[model samples]
Target: MNELFDQFDEFEDDLWGPIADDAMEPVADLSVGSAYQAPVEWNGIFTSPSEENNAYLPDVEPMDQTDLSSIQSLDSGELQPENMAESFFIEYPVFDPENADLEQIVGDPAQDMENWHMQSTQSSCALVSQEFILDKVLGRDVTEEELTSVATDAGWYTPGGGTPMNEMGRILEHFECQVDYDINCTMDDLSAKLEQGESILVALDSDEIWNTGADLDDILSEYFGMPGQDANHAVQVIGIDYSDQGSPKVILNDPGSPDGSGVMIPADKFMDAWEDSNHFMVSSGASQVSDQMIGNYYDRYGTWYYDDGTPERYNWDTGYY
Candidate 1:
């Protein structure tokens, strides 16, 4: 039995050795690009606990205008509220520097402006496109060898390694998915295109509408048709499958998970999920079409919600158009 096992081991190594060596040998055509930038350190402004007292509204008044005897009695209980007269206690919100109301303060406004600057400068840096991912699936007949060559030439990945979904955001550098807020096409049109085999970019403003009525699980099931996808997660639509299921299923490159993995979703509900997201896109070719298809209404903009009975208008330039 030992002799037979030893023979099998020798056969296995002999079979795979040349293949491994061939893969490792560098070709004249292969070129490796620089790595995507390492993540930047966060510099978001944070208000210290020490700043709490700065928020206080003092009740003191102008010093010289007050009566001398009243001032002398200030330290004792004999100075009743009525006797001292009422001093106004003004309250103001601590605001970001861009929105600070320093001019409203009675004294030299420089001190208030300085505090606002400090807080605003401490704000943390974040990946601008951290909300979406991008991937290009290899079509049939493209071997691992051919695909690697193309991906390298296109400046997409490392030679011997894989690029992460989150890292794509950093490499793209300033991930403005669209030029502005508007989407290019109608939901129906986008649906038809996605039904075809085109790669699409779906942007999600997780801070807004989609996160409203649903928990992470509900939202994931609704969007990807996978029940466990979380609210904190953002992914791109790479492929859609409809071979066996009643509805089409979307293939997504989910970044939050390990391996920057993929997931499939039921196809029919895809548009419903896209609309639930505040802003998104489906790139038909090398060019982006949000400007041509959906219009710029959502161009770099967000959405708002109110009570069900609140009056609303369908402004074409804003969304309905």
Candidate 2:
């Protein structure tokens, strides 16, 4: 992981371009009743234009500009950690289409548990993230204790260790799940996968998702300055929200959140924080093998087996199969 961070540090001098001078100006206030809205225009933030007649686009107006003060503070480098907001809120519109089949794909958000103040289980975010996907997306009843045991046996937990992206893949394989670790994937790639009824696990800096009372600008600035600062944390991407103008917002299930409910973030903000880790993510789903059968095999044999019924025998000493 350190090597990965080093490589990312050397890849660029600036992760994003300078913030436009007029970036903070609110474009429209589309707020209706008591519900929040998406901002109409973004000055410096850039998002991919929607594909022609994309059927997944939500039927709602663009978001209204809430408080963009943090953005300005980030641009000027004068933001302090003590002045950060308690939370960044964005109300995501429901995904409703006339076609019943399509609507089924965009169903409800996954259930998740919070890891807000639990420091002893710092490295367990990946396990928690995976558990939510299995339970909610794949219809499995997985308890946190069961996942912790699996992670411990897989050598994914240490006193102060973090789960590597590759380890996450191996862990999923135990349940007969296939995972693709892509460090070069874009938000569009994630959206496409969600449309196909797949769930995504993304690794991001912790500050980007939690409200730590620290200026987000300062936190991000410091993160870029020292790439080795252990900024890896995992979350699941379960849904997408499209603005009236067709821009997409990412909805995440942050295990680290207090409530662990769906958290909405603008695509650009999420991408910027994601870029620090090379946009690392694990796109996973049920594998060709039977999940139940494979899980039972792991429980009995203490290791995963290949599709051909060969044991993935791990040599405890060398820590490799």
Candidate 3:
């Protein structure tokens, strides 16, 4: 038996000796343009996927925010909300540095986002996202372990495997929040819902969204420039930062990051990563837990109880737009 196993091992090494590396090299470096811009320390939390999955990335059209003529404004000829184009998504405004309120965020980072939870496993982004949302909006003290057990029992998630892209809605519904899924969602759609103080969860490319740095754009210029497929990660959308008028950022509570609370990202880069999933989103009503001891929202057990109600409204004054 030992001699047979040894022979098999020798055959395996000879068959793939040139391809296999004892050190295991990264076949390609996606950040060719700005290797100096993105710090190496962030690579652990912000993964740089191998180029093998490049086939999955799609060509993303440029996002145009220049035309705001259709947007509602304080004007006589302003378009009514109902009259707006379905394609006329409410634009996410760029941050205006001169605004005193915008400058306040430099001191109060917690205004847009306050809390977060990191995933225990690399594949637990979905579950960890669930846990973080439930904890913040519902005040639910549920643990990630508990969420894993419940999600696994329902077959919504595999033990160590990633939750299916379509299964996120089921898990949210199971947790008592109303979920609306969009396979072809856009940033404008997000802006519209967020303005109403709703909770949003998005699945995008962790590497692309994380980029070289949290705020830096991808160094790769090609469509399949970066390695790996999109939608490999999920995060809770808290708000959009329009303080940097030229570079409006998407504020998110990314569960995959070590300290992901209130992570801000450039909108264009966000669109690039999001295009990977066709901008898949699961938008839901925020927790409605009131002062009353019990409320309408149910727990994981499905018992009728009380809890959080509608989420925080998008505040334009504080970069929450």
Candidate 4:
């Protein structure tokens, strides 16, 4: 048996030697533009989950006068509520950032504004949130790959990698789902949705939310060329707890975190962070229109239509008018 196996091995090596040598040989004078290069790191600000062993609360001092003023402007109602629910939560899969690798995924990082690390976390939040809504809420067993492909096609995974508030809604609509892009919303609004078994994706200032020490103002100025400051991090709101008396707390499936577990934040603190981006959130619902039907509508009417349902314009390159 050994002699027979040795003979087979010798035959295989003799037949494949030349092919292997040619494949291993380096190309001569490869042009820099043509050379395959790894994806570049994103220059935008990012918020990573804190690794410190301390409790969820940051080490910073209690809300000062300025902080309280900011929180008050964002949250109008009194902190203490008369009839608050015990607690509410949504069941959803969590995606962690630490596991992302650029080499494994294929997308245009420059157009998406997503570095490899940001793509893993940000895309995970959108993909997992959509999956939960589809499978649990809408009774559709959609796979992760399918959802990722949808996001990639929608330009959600482009250069910057994170989906904008408006783009988030459009992406959900592409799946024949309805989405509400709520801006300047309050905790009560978020809590009410969760109580109704709905999940929300929220944008937050990384520095305020995770204490990442990121200068959001500078980062936005440099990366987006925008003058005003905005939230730099995105997460999904899954649960809420009122057990802390006047200080209600929110439970989030933060992808920026290590384990993608529920990270609780004080309501006031959350409001402070969320207000940076006008408390932007995306709430999705099962659409009455089927996916195929919507596709057909677009195919006929084109992508851009007037309020009267007439085609406003057409792009020949995309085959959409």
Candidate 5:
């Protein structure tokens, strides 16, 4: 995790850009609304030489400007820990266009204690970020030998699953997520892997993920300073993709991916690419994981430690203390 943040620090300027006005509020100020947009003027007239006549043409007026105060101007620098707002927010896309549904992918599961939110989203809180999720799901934090051992263990592949792989898959399915398993397998293999009430990990591509900007590529290039293909920095991949292929895409699910709507990485590049960020993982318990694996989960992450030598907070967001 330190290594991952070090990567963040190394490319801090490129990813987030320089911190514009140092403000600490994790949540963007929603008071004023998005940038002030001018209102459209109806019945405006324009003289067109092409018309070859002095005619009163209906001029299309610009729209009224919105209150810019509510909407904060985002940049790469905003990814910094110190500058992160008090409450992060992200708008999830409609994964199932056929279904025409849209919702926020990441949030406090405590709000919904029943349903998949309780078992899947709630239990894997540590996987809020793409990097952490990938590390744990793929066992990236573990070495190649460890991964191989776990993959070939056969214990991970049996029915009525109890292995971490099976358990993680069930957790991911709540979000309709998929990931490249330690050992390559097809749809059938994945389906068979599930237990009576198990799920599959969602493998998200960076392009499909949503960001502050209308285009996700722009956001990745600007704020995070990481390229769209940088899979090493696995943030939580969110959003629903409904097409011939179901892709759960999202912004890098870092501590800064607003409201926990994390970013996505291509399954093919998800593992090798994000390694460029020097990622790591931290896990605990039978059915509970903090949103942050170990790095920056929230504002006070990495600041205080517990008497039992446990960390009081995690820095999944990478917000400065």
Candidate 6:
């Protein structure tokens, strides 16, 4: 194998980021009710909202775990070893999504999982983020265990290492999701996608994204005050914080940090970290197109693609395809 690190980002060593062991909870009954959203008004003319077309869900909270009876309090000799979440990956639980609930799964899974801010195990960042995106588009909870198990069985994830940098689309495709993968994506590509209201699963260097000094000991790591050393993290871009257009921050649901959800960092830092893995990314918005539809898209768009892997004649109204 080459000396260069393979592009992957499950969990390296639990060396950086917050560990929220107590926060990992089973995602059942996480669905929320839908309420009617008021329609827009134009020049004193208010459009009516039909029940089927106007319902909007409220802000969803991430999983809240309450079972902590196993934690040991300060006792003279009862000091048990800290509960290590990494131990769960010894044999990853293969969670199958097909058997998952498929009824009325119509809300963003992030709303139910709250961006799934909880930290991920060394081998579950991609799985966790994938769970969120899949569940969001499918409108239900697709457990991480199912994603992990399938990825492992499918050879997308190495036992101790992470996933290949560009297989995210194939994984999504395996689930029949309509996907677009880009190996050399640009910042404008990401911003435009977010503008269209779609979350992106991105691979960036954890060292830059979290500013963790875990890799500094390595001679090749960017000396202090720089990034692009460790290519070991996967996150989902939920939105872009444009409070400062000059230096807009990229908001992400980062699985590497303890409170990984709603994490934000300057766009430049994100881009630099992204460069560690060639700005590889994947976005899946609609369900996989039928074989007939696939034929039509290929016949129309051919093989020409933009930097973001978008077909020139893609139907953006659908997914910035």
TM-score of 6: 0.51
The candidate scoring highest on lDDT is 3
Q: Write candidate 3's Cα lDDT for 127-193 as tens digits.
A: 8777666665566455776566556656687654679889876656765577789978776788777
TM-score of each: 0.27, 0.53, 0.53, 0.47, 0.26, 0.51
Of 1 and 2, the candidate ranking higher by TM-score: 2
Clash count in backbone of candidate 2: 8
Better of 2 and 6 by TM-score: 2
lDDT-based ranking: 3, 2, 6, 4, 1, 5
Candidate that beats the other on TM-score, 4 or 6, i.e. the better one: 6
What is the lDDT for 115 in model 3? Answer: 49
Candidate 6 residue-wise lDDT at 258: 50
Position 262, candidate 6: lDDT: 59
True lDDT of residue 271, candidate 3: 84
lDDT of 5 by residue, 39-112 (tens): 22111211112221112223222233335555664564544434544533344432332343234232212211
RMSD of 4: 24.5
The model with the greater lDDT, 1 or 6, is 6
Candidate 6 off by > 4 Å = 1-113, 117-120, 212-229, 288-321
| Candidate 4, superposed: residue stretches over 4 Å from native | 1-124, 212-231, 287-321
Count the clashes in each prediction: 24, 8, 17, 16, 85, 10
Model 4: per-residue lDDT, tens digit, 34-93? Answer: 322112223221122222212222232212122222233333232112111221122232
Candidate order by TM-score, decreasing, is: 2, 3, 6, 4, 1, 5
lDDT of 2 at 150: 57
Model 6 worst lDDT run, 10 consecutive residues:
87-96
lDDT of 1 by residue, 1-321 (tens): 699898998875544333223322232221233221111111111122122222232222122222243334233332233432232111112223244343421122222122111000101001111222211221112122322322333345343234333333332222133222235445444445454533344644323322334455554434422343423223445444434445544444433222222334434444545554443453433224221322223222232212221112333223341
